[model samples]
Target: MGRLTWIGIMVALAAGFSAGAVFGPVLMPRPGAASNPNLIDLSALPDELREKHRNEDFLRNEATNYAHMQEALAQRAAERAARAPLDLPNGMESVPFGLVYKPGGDVHWPEGMTGELGDALEAAKDGWVILNYWASWCGPCVHELPEMGKAAPLYADRGITLIAVNTDPMRKDTPDSARALFASKGIESLAPYVAEGTAVDQMMAAADMTMANVSLPTNIIYAPGGTPYAVFEGGNLSDSPVWTAPQTLAFLDVLAKGE
Candidate 1:
């Protein structure tokens, strides 16, 4: 069978494995299920089965998840490569969500954004920038924040930077508060930058977007050379994107490279 066919089979099997996690393996600090929602409750198993299969099941489930994720990534990458755009002004252009390609130009940040958040954006102008907006009150933002932090490191290797800016309105919005929140959430790898002072309206204006078109959990994407776009806006926990997922990394790699 061809490689794509093999990947398809593996993905299907992974779905089955994930569904059968109770009969499969993996555990977490949580009393019952594994940290990954995909895996089932380990503590619920019979005492002997839990003891006998704890390590083995964990290893098996992790290995399978990783392998399946990679296979899916490679298969999708192949399909994406086959459909890459041909025309470009400077021999290249911005591709957003692989949905549309446009002239890749320098993005202009609004003047009001003038601190750590602005500095972070300025420093990463040479590559892809993923600006994620989140507020403490927004349930969906809290759900996806940790996943984004976990994926931040992987993004650096692919020339992408994920800047998760907190817009929590209740607090004074200090650096220490931001760092504290990240620590509380177990997000150590990514920077602790809050954008409370920097209004969402400022960002929307910079991207030429209107309030009618935007909502909470707005993720503003900046293509290489600094073209800006907003997407993945207005979603609840059910719609949250797991940034650490392999498919996410692969899609990012494709977007970051403009390939």
Candidate 2:
């Protein structure tokens, strides 16, 4: 094969590997999945290419298995909830969420999030969408990230998309840094979304909520059809109404079953 021809083959394989990393881990894509048009004809690739393809498929299957395990664990947690419902702790507001989803409010999507969420939120409109604000400097945010990550697979079960918007870009919070943090913590279920110039104001507007003296590190939940469902303002989950990851898994299970 000519030099350039070999290069083309490698390039195609690289693309497949990267694509596989994204959708493969969660969706558990098969090499011959009918919808995958970009999948190369592996039968023709040299031994090296074939080996890499096999490794990629192995990794993808492993990720899918891990996600399934988390989901099964989540199902068990739901059973526990059925036996004994979770009660709002003292000092926590009785409201299902700090803020209830209001109808027809004008939600100002942050500039970058608009195009992304326009499609994502709409597609997930039939299920659930979770938006969170976080920064590396915030201790609580960092602590909560892993917890949220743990529940992410469960959340994704019913068309859910969890987005954590990074803050303090001016203070040197970049997407890469956030990703590094997540990677360090063994978090694969969610990715850090960069929302430039996003503040409490922008996030509040994005969730179609008015400023109610809430601060950063806000957590907002959306019900099916992209409607604002609830907002759990910042605080330590252990000490506040913000549901812990396990609690949320149970809640989402109950929700998906319409119980």
Top-scoring candidate (TM-score): 1
| Root-mean-square deviation (CA) per prediction | 15.8, 20.8
Cα error, residue 13 of model 2, in Å, equals 49
TM-score of 2: 0.49
lDDT of each: 0.57, 0.53
Question: How do all models score by TM-score?
Answer: 0.52, 0.49
**What tens-digit string does per-residue lDDT give for candidate 2 at 61-121?**
6466555445544653353234322243333334423332332345433333455434554
Clashes of 1: 0
Q: Count the backbone clashes (under 3 Å) in each candidate.
A: 0, 1
Judged by lDDT against the true structure, how good is candidate 1?
0.57
Clash-forming residue pairs, model 1: none
